[model samples]
Target chain A: MDKEKYAKLEQKISPKPPLLKNVIKAFLVGGTICLIAQFIALFYMTFFNFTERTASNPTVATMIFISMLLTGFGVYKKIGQVGGAGGAVPITGFGNAVVSAAIEHKSEGFVLGVGSNIFKLAGSVIVFGVFSAFLVALVKTILVKMGVVSW
Target chain B: MFSIYITSFIVGGLICVIGQLLFDVAKLTPAHTLCILVVTGSVLDGLGLYEPLIDFAGTGATIPITSFGNALTHGALAEAEKHGLIGVLTGMFEVTSSGISAAILFGFIASFIFKPKGSV
Candidate 1:
């Protein structure tokens, strides 16, 4: 068989993922996480003197905390496997990344292993997060100073 | 209130769908996608765009990593206003300290207790 024919033959035999099922699963799981977060924020707003805007910080912190606990118990990995991007695209995934790295590297010893490698995945997140924020802030400040756009 | 909930759900779900598309079509790694999201959030927040999104979508907008970046920038800018140049140094991390510290602390404890399921 020619190369193209051989490739097509191989493609025909390969198992296809259930794309629709996975999308539905992802949508449900992701929406569930956001729903929980929203509830938490509402709780804070109702009981604590926080407005909708102010409640976000505590809501995110609580979600990350819950994710870390789940990661510790080895539950999050299962979630990631089943939920795929649904499990990961939220802040919980960020928690999983940090804790999983630390767990993976724990055998190498404390400071160098757990400490250093803990941020291996998340470090990029923080670095880029801060850098991007700085750049945008700088541009905003310049534009405001020059009166190019009034804020 | 009901409309807010519906919008939040749709927006949050859509963001995840976009992430899924990136993973499937673009084959971007999770880390790369996350970084991109954070950067996008920061840029939008800095441009004063994300605030409106937050107003419209609430937790739908905030639960994503982009909101974290948005909070960092807003915190730093607020601090810079109060403390001048010194605020720039202390502001960003201060805003995010709770989340960061919690992750580190919980991660450290979890690592100490849990053994790897597979070869590290």
Candidate 2:
């Protein structure tokens, strides 16, 4: 550990998660999430007559929704104990963030407290990402219009 | 195809190994290391140098947080073309919504039960 960097990082508020467990959790949770998604897709294909390709998207959406529900119910916490970032970095993790924030502040009243801040940190990140992409796209369009480069 | 899969697995493993070395042996912090790898990958990709690596590795490149940033950039750029200045937000969220949704759902669940033991 770099003393200087450690000192600096230590000042920041974050969990001191166990490395091995988190890594294992990430692998297991991430894989399991993917496996569950595959199962959903297979089920859709088998019962509903959806094509494999067609089944993929709805399966993903369903997975995210289920993940959100889990996060709302606090079951993901148990998964996180084993999966860490493997669980946290996936789409399900994002759902957890918004819902959890809402749950945390639900006492403030649904609209102002829970609903308003539901996106909170994750919202900002998405917003920033979207905004920045728009700017870049605009520039590219302007350049393209001016015959600067071909798409 | 089999060779490609094997190569991807190896290269992806190597990236993790390098990440581990950086975390365990180097003086650099995890965020810093992650940042460096992602930025390096992005810059190389922007310069058209990383495509071959991506082709060979697939998820090796996409699994990293930096790839997430690249996806955001690509999404924003694509949307901005359609929606003018507003595309930034539109493009980014549209492309990444699935991932974001997933993250939020899981994060929410974890937070409720584990309560994150620490503060932001």
Candidate 3:
């Protein structure tokens, strides 16, 4: 029965590609995200004495925040609609993921319902990311100490 | 500079191509695929394999799910280092709150005005 179900499912094709409107919306929304990052980079460079090279980190940080805000307000869904993954795939889009998930689950309550679970998807991603990077950084630090690598 | 640009363009395009193939050819939802990509990117980055790819490809590597993971990790670490235990939560938000707020605010406004239609 499972094999037959799998076979039947595999044979189906979506009637069309994701809608053109969605693609364009994604393009515009995604492009807007990039533009915001550029602005943040420029701002850091101009006001904080950060070099062009150093400003990228802050820019990425800013983009994530903006996407989070957008997700909360619900504009990203529109963008996601028009943009599909185009709108939903960027760093800001990741923000949308966390916030939207929280919003979806918000009816549960505040502490566990909204506050703790608000950033569920994003939180997991961050946890894994930080832990993994720590391991990498540790290896690099050890290697550098041993003169096997240089920063 | 020209060579760098060319390399980034090609690599970014390739990354998108693979992502697209995963979307169109494979049987995964976009979010699921993105989650997988982000995790994969983070692991590769953790192994230090992704850094070189990032140096070479710039936007290609930076534009995907992995980049998101990298940012989260970087933010959390920075926060934790500065404030100890409390910094973990504060760090994540402090690092990302602005952009996240911006995204949510604008997304909310847009949704309110435009009423985007789709299944979540």
RMSD of each: 3.0, 7.2, 6.3
Query: What tens-digit string does per-residue lDDT give for candidate 1 at A1-151?
Result: 8999999999899876567766777777777788788889889999999999778878877898899778877788888877777788788888889989999899899898999999998888899989887777666666666778755
- For candidate 3, the lDDT comes to 0.55
Runs in model 3 with CA error above 4 Å? Answer: A1-6, A9-32, A138-151, B1-17, B43-63, B68-120
TM-score of chain B of 3: 0.67
Q: Please give me the DockQ of candidate 1 compared with the native complex.
A: 0.58
Which sections of candidate 2 miss by over 4 Å?
A1-21, A42-57, A139-150, B1-120
Report the lDDT tens digits of candidate 3 across residue range A59-116: 6566656665666556677776665555556676666766576566555654565566
Cα lDDT of model 2 by residue, B1-120, tens digit: 345444544554455545444544464653455554544544443333444664665444444344445566666566666776566556665544556555545544444543322321
* Descending-TM-score candidate ranking: 1, 3, 2
Which of the two, 1 or 2, has more TM-score? 1
Candidate 2 - chain A - TM: 0.69
CAPRI category for model 3:
incorrect
In model 3 chain B, which range of ten residues has the least summed lDDT? B108-117
- Model 1, range B41-94, lDDT digits (tens) per residue? 888877888889989988888887777788778776666667754565567776
- Candidate 1: misplaced stretches above 4 Å? A1-19, B80-90, B118-120
Fnat for candidate 2 (0 to 1): 0.15
Q: How close is candidate 2 to the true structure, as a TM-score?
A: 0.56
* Worst lDDT 10-window in candidate 1 chain A: A136-145
